[model samples]
Each structure stands twice: as C-alpha cells, then as structure tokens.
Target: MKEYKISLPICENDIDTLQAGDYVYLTGTVYTARDAAHLRMYEAAGRGEDLPFDIKGSVIYYLGPSPAREGQVIGSAGPTTSGRMDKYTPTLLDMGLKAMIGKGRRSPEVIESMKKNGAVYFAAVGGAGALLSKCIKSAEVIAYDDLGTEAIRKLYVEDLPVITVIDREGNNLYDSV
Candidate 1:
C-alpha cells in the first residue's frame, strides 16, 4: 500500500489516489464533532438554517477531546467510535464531506455513500489520545459550546496519522486481514 502526506480541503484527486490499507499523515484543518454535535447539525439542516461551517471538501474527525490542560492547544484528542455517527454519515457525505476519521468499521450504506460520493473513511488508533493530542496544533470551538467537550471544534493538525479503512471504491482494510 502507498502512503500519503496530504493537506485537507481534500479534492476528488486526493481521494482517488488513496485506497484501503494505505497510510496518511494529514496536515491542515480538520473539524471535530461527536454524536451530540452531529445531532445538532442534522437538526440545523432540517430547520433550513445555515450550517455552522462550510462542510464541502472537508474532513470530519469523530472526536470529543478532553479539556486542554492549562497552557496547551488540546488534550487527549483521540478518535471516538465511528459507529455512533452511522445514521448521520450518508447525509453529510451527500453534502460534500470528503473524509471521515475515527475508530472502527462503517456500515454498508455508509460505505456505499463513500463510493458514490468519492469519499473515504480512515481509522486512527484508539487509546492513543495523549499521543494524538501532540499532532493537533490548535483547537477552537466553532459551535455548540454548551456541550462542553462535546462541542464542535476546529483543529489545525500536522502529520496526524490515519489508515485508510475504506476507500472510495469500497475496499475495506478492516476486513483485508
């Protein structure tokens, strides 16, 4: 498998070049939103309101990091279970979300959406929150602040590692072994 060092706001060409089992180091901005933030975003969409941010071509990280320790950018910023976002995945993908970073396998319909939309799913090692935090250079709440740690955060990351779990062609690394 090939490896890539990519910047975000990923385009079709970027997703096309990746495949299941390949590694990636993402440098650029990525958004963080766990279950609660997703629910809010879904509701906001249903209400015909503006989304908190432009999602097109963006990568969403399924993370709800702990409060940053004093004098730090973030703390223990690890991926959460992606299954939690299954119901919301296709809709977001349809709206131009190009990639998702989280832990665990995705559902069939989600993979289909990835195929039809030319998106990708990536897996970051769970339980490596402390180490993961080191890659996040900055973190700021963009919306839903009342949820505290569950709030949507915009993170600027450098060399944040992930494995392509499912490629646009529906190849799944999780089952490859």
Candidate 2:
C-alpha cells in the first residue's frame, strides 16, 4: 500500500491518486457529523434548502466527540460506526462530498455511489479516540447545538491518520481481507 499526505477540500485529482489500503495523513478542515447530523442535512436537501456548510469537496468524519477536559481542543474524537448513515450517504456523495472517515463496511449502494461520484472512504482505527483527539487542533460547533456532542463541528486537523478503505474506483479493502 502507498502512503500519502493530503490536504482537505480534496479534489478529483486527489481522489484519482488514492487506492484502497493506502495510508493517509490528512491535514486541513474536516467536518464532524454523526447519523443525526446526516439526517438533518438530507432532509434540508430534500426541501431545497441550504445545508449548514458547503458540501463541495468536503471531508466528513462520522464523529460525535465527548466534552473536553480543561485546556483540551476536543474530547475523545473517534469515528462512530458507519453503517448507520448508509441510507443517507448516497445523497451526500451526489451532493459533492469528497470523502468520509469512519469505521465499518458501507452498504453496497453507498459503494456504488462513491464510484459514480468519485469519492473515497477512509477508516480510522476504532477505540483510539483519545489518541485521535490529539490531532485535532481546533473545534467549534457550527450547527445543531441541541444535539450536543452530535452537533456539527468544524475541526482543523493536523496529520490525522486514516486508511483508504474504499477508493474512487470502487476497490474495497474489506473485500481483500
């Protein structure tokens, strides 16, 4: 597998260079959203309303971090199970979402949409929340404050590690294992 360091707002060119199982360290803006946030965005789109943030070229992490301790930028910022968002993923992909960071296999429909939309999927190691939080340099809730930890947060990450579990060409690392 190859290793790459990528910046956020990844474009089609960046997606083209990635392959399943590649190691990547992402440094840039990443939005955190869990299933609750996804559902809100999906509903907003259906109503022809604007999403809270620009969806184009965005990388979303399916995370809902806990309350931070004193002096911390964020709490345990781990990825949640991805399957719960399967029903809403295809729509987001078509809306210009570039990549997603989460754990677990995605549904076949989500995989197909990724191929059609030229998106990538990254997997963060689960149960490594404490370590991952160190990569987040800043965090601010940008929407859905009522959801508390599940609120959509704009995070600036530095060298956050992830594995390319599914590439734009539809290669799936899970299938290889």
- Could you say which candidate leads in lDDT? 2
C-alpha root-mean-square deviation, candidate 1: 0.8
Model 1, span 1-177: residue lDDT tens = 789999988778889999899999999999999999999988887787877889898899999998887999998989999998999889888888999999997899999999999999999999999999999998999999999988989999999999999999999998878
- In candidate 2, list every pair of residues with a backbone clash: none
Best by TM-score: 2
**Candidate 2 local lDDT, 65-166, one digit each (tens):** 989999999999989999999999999999999999999999999999999999999999999999999999999999999999989999999999999999
For candidate 2, give the lDDT of residue 121: 98
Report residue 144 deviation for candidate 1 (angstroms). 0.1
| Candidate 1: C-alpha lDDT | 0.92
The global C-alpha lDDT for each of the candidates, from Candidate 1 onward, is: 0.92, 0.95
Give the C-alpha lDDT of model 2: 0.95
Q: What is the lDDT of residue 132 in candidate 1?
A: 93
lDDT of 1 at 48: 77
Q: RMSD, each candidate, Å?
A: 0.8, 0.6
